[model samples]
Target: MNAKYVKRKSYLNFLQRHKDKPIIKVVSGVRRSGKSTLFLLFKQELIDSGVPENHIISVNFENMAFDELRDPQKLYRYLKKMTTEESMYYIFLDEIQHVQEFERVVDSLFLENNVDLYITGSNAYFLSGEIATLLSGRYVELAMLPLSFQEYVNWHKQNDRYKTDEAFFNDYLKSSFPYALFTDNDQELLEYLQGLYSTVVLNDIITRLSVQDVQVLEKVLATLFSTIGSLVNTNKLTNTLKSAGAAISNKTVEKYIAGILDSLIMYRAERYDIHGRQLLNSQEKYYVVDIGLRQLILRDHREDFGHIVENIVYLELLRRYQKVYVGKTKKYEVDFVAINDQQEITYYQVALTALDEQVLTRELRSLQSIDDQYPKYLLTLDQLNKTANYDGIKKMNVIDWLLQA
Candidate 1:
């Protein structure tokens, strides 16, 4: 079955903003994260915006027809044949990493004043080393992530108008990926996600890094997935792996973690120095790229609402383009410290249900400890009639905040 593609509003806005810039547009994310679909969407938008069909050229390296362009020289020659000096050209290259010495092709293309280039890659190594050196100041990266919770909700609302808590929960479990929204079958989606995960682990991580300890790397990833939202240290990860009979060193653990981060499978949120008002250097929290991937890795126990709250918080920060961190005060800890170019905001806590008096008190105490006045919020799953505002903090339901935001 062919999958229906939904237009991503955020990516479209990014393209419109940079349409006239000379900088190369680079869209990067994990495999099957809808990068290719976004490229096609942008291409359509360009055509609609009056870019002639002859002026826009797109090549997917994964396509069998372009398999011969694996050589840089051959790829450059093919592109040269399609482009002309009379008119400006828009070049969209998908999975450009498959080409050997891709930086040469990019550099050659960039030298031409008539071409505007856009490229997509599944891994960060695609932009590393020679490419970074060659196109140092000529590119703008547009990071693509898995479907945000808001996008996820928008996707399901298309088929069903009546949204009950149970229905939304079922949709959340099923259509976590943008691609999954096209299908209703759960088992088939799980199988596809499993295959996609294997490709990322094998082709993206292992092949790119060329590591001998595959088992150790897998163990590290599994550990990270299992311990999402917890503050993690390299030494502690090394100790845990050693205790599990993995025999991996702290340095190896650190390198493996970096590899995962480079692949965009996991993001590490650093600790913030609240007193000094700066980002701290040590002990950070890691969130998986998608909750579905976490569920795929850890199959049996998937109802970790605390981790889900963490995931939502991480996505919210990304959406707002906030510099987020785990915040600590003298008395208590804040869940997030979101700072942008202009303002600084502190977030307090998250819980699945704050029905209990003890849970409510515990969640509020974290926000109350902070001396400064910023927007403090307690995100909970409970849909209470009244919103309690203590001192300067506001307590609201997570679903309401997500929908409203």
Candidate 2:
């Protein structure tokens, strides 16, 4: 089945805003989160705006045909030779981590006046170590993710039945990877997720980290995946695995978790002390990159739908904010504290349902504890009043909040 690509306007807008600027455009995301497709869409937009096709030089290192070009010198020569015209040449390199010393190629291209460089990678570490120091402030990174709930809803509103809850259920159950849209059935989707998960683990994690014990790594992943939205520390995780029959050290567990985070399979949110105005170096929470992948890894995770909803809310915050943290007051905890590019802050509390008076009060207490007057929100699945305000705090349906642009 041919997959219809939804125009990811947010990411596309980022590219359009940075078009032909002196800075390099770097797209980073988990594998199959539509990095290549985003580049393709932006390239098409350039062509539509009258940029000649021959001025675009695109290469995916994953393709065997580009095997020889994996050498930094050959790749540099090829790109240099491609820029024959006096106008700008748009160059996109996909999965560039496959190339050794890719920073050199990227650094060399940045010096050319007529070259506009854009690159994509599945591993976050590719931007660390050498490339980071080399490119310092020379490039801007547009971190990408799989489709948001709004994206899912917009894409399926006309093609399928648009029951709000059902649509969300389908998106949550099937998978959020862009390619999952073309899958015909549950079995096909599961197989696709399995392959995607294996690729991330085998290629991005195990092989990249030189980890030898696959079973231990699987255990670490299972533990982390099942505990999304909960505080985790390496020592505790090591103890838990030891009791469960896996013999692993705390350092090893730490290394494996670092590998997992670097691979973009999961994200860590540090605790921020709201009153102290500083980050607390205590237990940090981990959220999986995609909820559907969580489901696949922990089949029995249906029991914690509340945390699942929290996980979804966290991912949405990530897409909307520059920095997200688990907010901590002197006496209470807020679900999320989002800070934007303008340095504005927002506090959020997520719950599966706040219909019960007790649950509602409990959820509100955290946001109320924050003394600052920054915008505060309480997001829940409850739809009774749909929208309401509590002491200047806005309470709205999580689904509705997600759909907001």
Candidate 3:
């Protein structure tokens, strides 16, 4: 099947906002989360907005065509030839971490008067290490994520004749990466996801870090994936792996977990301070990049639908660029503490089904515990009842809420 065009309106807006800025627009996300595709889309937007095609210089370092330009000096000279002083030049470099000494080339291009730069990479090391120091205060990092449920819905609406139901569509959430939505064949899609996972493990994590103990890293990742939406600690994970005969140390486990975070395969949500209103240091929760990969790794029982709901909620908050955390009050605990630049906070509670009386109370109690007047919401699969308010908190069907945003 031909690749379907799923419009990523949010990312398009981001590009349009930062088009003429001198700072580099750095896009970072997990592997195959549509970073390259979004870059192409932004390029097309620029062309449509009246920029000449020749003024836009694009390069994918992963492509064999640029293999010889691995050295920073050669890359600098190549770009110098393409750019001119007369007009504004837009330069795009995709998967730029594949090139050796890439920071030097980026730094040089940024110094050029006529260039507006954009780059994409799959690893956090691209931001955390020398590149960050080299371009300090001169870049804006746009963290990308897999398709939101709404994006997935719109994508399906474009081609498929059969309209997918909520329960059926929930299966698509099982796979966290957006590219998997392109194909209809289940086996082919699974195989493709598996291959992408392996590539990320090998290329983005192990090879980039020069990690020696692949077994220990794999064990840590498996443990994290299996325990999604639960509080986790390095010491506990280290002990568990030791019991399983992995012989991994706590310090190494911490490092490996950080590596995983850097690769964007998993995200850590720290505990939020309720009274002092700061991020707490202990017992942070981790969520996987894609739910489907989580299912693939833990093939036994799929009984943790509540945790899956939590996972989906986490991704939605991330899609909005909200800083999310576990919120604890005196009497209860909120599932997520979403905060934006305005210091505005929203309390969210997620449950698979709030139909049961006990389930509804348990989810609502957390939001009630917070004495503040911030917006409180309980998101679930309870769609038959569409009451806007429940005990002062907003009651929203998770699917409806996702589609709305």
Highest TM-score, which number?
2
Order by lDDT, highest first: 2, 3, 1
Which numbered prediction scores highest in lDDT against the true structure? 2
Judge candidate 2 against the unseen true structure and give its global Cα lDDT, from 0 to 1: 0.89
Clashing pairs in 1: none
lDDT of 3 at 43: 81
Scanning candidate 2 in windows of ten residues, the lowest lDDT window is 164-173
State the lDDT of candidate 2 residue by residue for 178-292, as single tens digits.
Answer: 8777788878988889999999999999998898889999999999999898888778899999999998998899999999999999999999999988999889999999888
Compute each candidate's TM-score over C-alphas: 0.92, 0.97, 0.95
Candidate RMSDs in order: 2.4, 1.5, 1.9
Model 2 ranges off by over 4 Å? 1-3, 158-161
- What is the per-residue lDDT of model 3 for residues 1-405, given as tens digits with 9 covering 90 to 100? 124656788987888889888888899999889898887777888888899999999888889999878777888889999996668999999999878888888888888889999999998887776668878998888889888887887777666644646854666666747767656776777788789889989987888678898988888999998888888977888899999999778778888888889889889999887877887777889998888888767777388888987898898998874588888776666889998878798888988788788977788888887888988898888876655587689888887888886
Stretches of candidate 1 above 4 Å error? 1-3, 160-162, 346-348
- Screening candidate 2 with a backbone cut-off below 3 angstroms (N, C-alpha, C), the clashing residue pairs are none
Q: Ranking under TM-score, best-scoring first?
A: 2, 3, 1
